[model samples]
Target: MSNMNVIVEKLLAIDGALAAAIVDSNSGMILGSGGSGVDLELAAAGNTEVVRAKTKTMKSLGLKDNIEDILITLGKQYHILRPIDKQDGLFIYAVLDKSKANLALARRKVLDAEQALVM
Candidate 1:
């Protein structure tokens, strides 16, 4: 299993990756982060809310499903929030330059990193 730093490093190796972090959705805290461009700390906190809101909405609707990832596309960036399948209240947040990123490949890489993440 990979540690947090290792996971962040692997994420950075992906094309167009601008930043990456492991965040706790429960408290909106960042456990580990790497790379640059956007403010990872702020992003982690904000995205935590996004996760909470989505989960709440899902439960309200009684959707018997899980969120694989949340993708936010901006004019210049692509933000990915993937909840760790092995743990509760933790997630992987990755930001990428839209012009430089291959969304499919990036998503696949995130999934690969998620599976190997130790904590």
Candidate 2:
């Protein structure tokens, strides 16, 4: 299994990774992070809302399925937010350059990292 640092580093190894952070959703706080193109602190706060909104919407819609991840695509970037199943109220946020990232592979890596991560 990987620790936070290792997980962040592994994420940075992705072809287009610009930044990555492990965030606490309950507090919108960043626990650990690596890489830098965007400000991770700000990203954490914004993504916290992203998670909350989706969760709230799901509840309202009466969808019983849990969210595995959320993807936000911009003109040049891709923001991926993945909640860690084993770590309650925590998530992995990764930003990638859309021009270089393979979305499928990046998502898979985040999933693997989540499994290996220790709360």
Candidate 3:
């Protein structure tokens, strides 16, 4: 298993990664983070709401499945949220410059990192 710092470092290695944070959905807190283009502290809280809302909606719809990831595309960047398969209430938030990133590869990298992340 990799430490939090290492995981954050790995996330930053992705092309165009602006920032990455490990967020606790239950509390909207950033457990660990790296990179600098964005304010992860603020993003964590807002994104927590995003996760919670989606979860609630899924439950309401009776969708009996897990979320692989959440993507929010912007004109200049993409925000990716990857919740751990084995760990409830925790997720990785990544931002990438849309022009520089390969969406498919970035998603795959997040999944690979999620499996190795230490809670």
Best by TM-score: 1
User: lDDT of each model, Cα atoms only?
Assistant: 0.95, 0.93, 0.92
> How accurate locally is residue 114 in candidate 3, as Cα lDDT from 0 to 100?
92
State residue 93's C-alpha deviation in candidate 2, in Å: 0.2
Error of 3 at 96 (Å): 0.4
Q: Tell me model 2's lDDT, rounded to 2 decimals.
A: 0.93
Q: What is the TM-score of each candidate against the true structure?
A: 0.97, 0.95, 0.96
Badly placed stretches (over 4 Å) of model 1 are none
lDDT of 3 by residue, 1-119 (tens): 54888889999999988899899999999988998888888999999999999999999999999989999999999999998877899999999999999999999998888988865
Task: Kindly list the per-residue Cα lDDT of model 1 for residues 1-119, writing each as its tens digit.
Answer: 44999999999999999999999999999998999999898899999999999999999999999999999999999999999989999999999999999999999999999999995
lDDT score of residue 79 within candidate 1:
99
* Candidate 1 Cα RMSD (Å): 1.0
What clash pairs does model 2 have? Answer: none
Error of 1 at 8 (Å): 0.4
* Evaluation by lDDT, superior candidate among 2 and 3: 2
